[model samples]
Target: MAKITYIEHNGTEHVVEVANGMTVMEGARDNSIPGIEADCGGACACSTCHVYVHPDWVDRLPGKDSMEEDMLDFAYEPDTQRSRLTCQLKVTDALDGLVVQLPEKQI
Candidate 1:
């Protein structure tokens, strides 16, 4: 499992243990972390699960695909370098201590 940290716009922090093979969005949803709405469940059909990966982890995580990149265009104030769709991030041991910051609002 990986220990992931989800930070809300107001600075609220939620640290949870996510099993390998689960998506980052699933980790937040299962833990009832409020910042990630995950409107489409684990499917990358919406941008409600958008987050800004901590700069320190931007490269450590997997690269975004065309689909995730397209969905991010609909996210709230997306950052070219840090923005990502949580549903697209599969958890692994390498993601231990991953930190993601939620946007003020999701579009």
Candidate 2:
């Protein structure tokens, strides 16, 4: 399992242990972490799972694919560098202490 932290726009923090192979969005939903809507259920078809990966770990994550980049165009307050869809981030030992910041809204 990997321990991941989800910080809301209001500064609320939720730390949870996610099983390896599960998506970050699944971790949030399973643990009831607020701010991750995941409307498309990790299908990469929606942007409701948008988040800002802490700069410290950004370089450690895999680069986004073209589909995710296109979907991000619909994210709220999107940040090309930090913004990412939680559904695209798979939990792994390498990301044990990953921290992601939630946006104010997900429409």
Candidate 3:
């Protein structure tokens, strides 16, 4: 399992232990973290799961794919460098302490 932290725009924090192989979006949803909407599930077809990966960990994550980049154009408050769709981030042993901050809004 990996321990992931989800910080809301309001500074609320949710730390969860997520199974490896699950998406970050799934971890938040399963743990009842309020900020991740994940409207399209993990399909990468929507931007409701947008998050800002902590700067310290950004370089550790896999680069975003073209499809995720295109979808992020629809995110509520986009940040070209830090923005990511949580659904695109898979939990793994190597990402045990990943931290992601939620936007002020999803829709």
Candidate 4:
């Protein structure tokens, strides 16, 4: 399992353990972390689960696919380098201690 930190725009932080193979969005939804609405339920069809990967972990995570990139366009104030759709990120041992900050709002 990986321990991921989800930080809200208002500075709240939720750190939870996510099982391997589960999407990051699932981790937030299951743990009841606010800010990640996940309207599509980890289907990669919506931007409600968007977050900005902490700069320190930016290069550490996997690259985004076309679907994730497209979905991010609908996120609120997406940052080209850091914005990502949580549903597209799968948990793994390598992602342990990963940190992501929620946008001010999800569009």
* Model 2 lDDT per residue over 1-107, tens place: 99999999999999999999999999999999988999988999999999999999889999999999999999999998999999999888999999999999997
Model 1: CA > 4 A from native:
none
- Which residue runs does candidate 4 get wrong by more than 4 Å? none
Better of 2 and 3 by TM-score: 2
Q: Which should have the higher TM-score, number 1 or number 3?
A: 1
What TM-scores do the predictions have? 0.98, 0.98, 0.97, 0.97
lDDT of 3: 0.93
lDDT of 1 by residue, 71-97 (tens): 999999999999999999999999999
Q: Give the TM-score of candidate 1.
A: 0.98
Candidates sorted on TM-score, descending:
2, 1, 3, 4
Show the lowest summed lDDT stretch of 10 residues, model 1.
35-44
Clashing pairs for model 4 are: none
Stretches of candidate 3 exceeding 4 Å from the true structure: none
Residue-level error in angstroms, candidate 3, position 94: 0.9
